[model samples]
Target: MPDNEETLVDVRSLHHRLVRINRVLRLAGSGSGLSAGTAAALWSITQHAPLRLSRLAEIESVSTPAISRIVTSLESMGYVERRADPDDARARLLYPTDAGRDVMSTARNARVLRLAEALDRLEPADRDMVERAFEVLSDALVPPEA
Candidate 1:
């Protein structure tokens, strides 16, 4: 294993690279007219439908009012809707509309295509190395329950 200083240096380099990659991916995937926060909230709603706004705020690490604004934007765009929670009439659940799912699908396809184009430039061995490295990092970073 490397010394602490070496590990820190490598980690910093990895962070920089990941940030750049994320920026590229975000641009590629954001063909939708929605802002980043609004797009992200819609995607999350699609993934975890029938969930409370409070839970979504927690998941997104934003305040309730902030998420509420995003959700309002989404609703205006016809991307998301709120339904009375079956368990509690006082609480409402968020669900993505069909239009919302279509937007997300289109965005996801664009991002995948962009990434695939980049990966295609690499040699087969380098591509394999990237895959292995991604797997290792994902396993290390993700919680066991996740």
Candidate 2:
């Protein structure tokens, strides 16, 4: 090793920059109409349709009030609809409307396009290596609960 070699601290600075970049990419996508949290809420409901609000809050690990606000916003935008639960009259079942599915699909496509373009500029071999590394990183990052 060269004398100039330095320790790979994997410091707080790197973590901060990584987080900032992720946020920037999220904001710079087809999600111009909705905030990030709202978009996440939409995605969650899309994945778990006819889901309950309490369950959604638990899955998202957010306060019930926060999820209610997001659901309210989604309802007003016609992105989601709430109906009485068939199993429980006191509870409600939430589902995305056609418009909501359209929005979710658009957002997913935009995010994929942006990421693909960014990786496309790299050499094919390098891209493959990075992709593999990302898979490993993803596996490592998943929490036990996930």
Best by lDDT: 1
Clashes of 1: 0
lDDT of 2 by residue, 46-91 (tens): 9999899999999889999999999999999999999999988999
- What are the per-residue Cα lDDT tens digits for candidate 1 across 43-121? 8999989799999999888999999999998999899999999999999999999999999999999999999999999
RMSD of 1: 2.0
Q: For each candidate, give its TM-score against the true structure.
A: 0.93, 0.85
Q: What is the lDDT of residue 88 in candidate 2?
A: 87
User: Clashing residue pairs, candidate 2?
Assistant: none
Candidate 2 at residue 94, lDDT? Answer: 94
Which 10 residues in a row give candidate 1 its minimum summed lDDT? 137-146
lDDT score at residue 97, model 1, on the 0-100 scale: 92
Each prediction's total of clashing residue pairs, residues at least 3 apart in sequence or on different chains, is 0, 0
After the best TM-score superposition of candidate 2, give how far the Cα of residue 124 lies from its true spot, in angstroms. 1.3
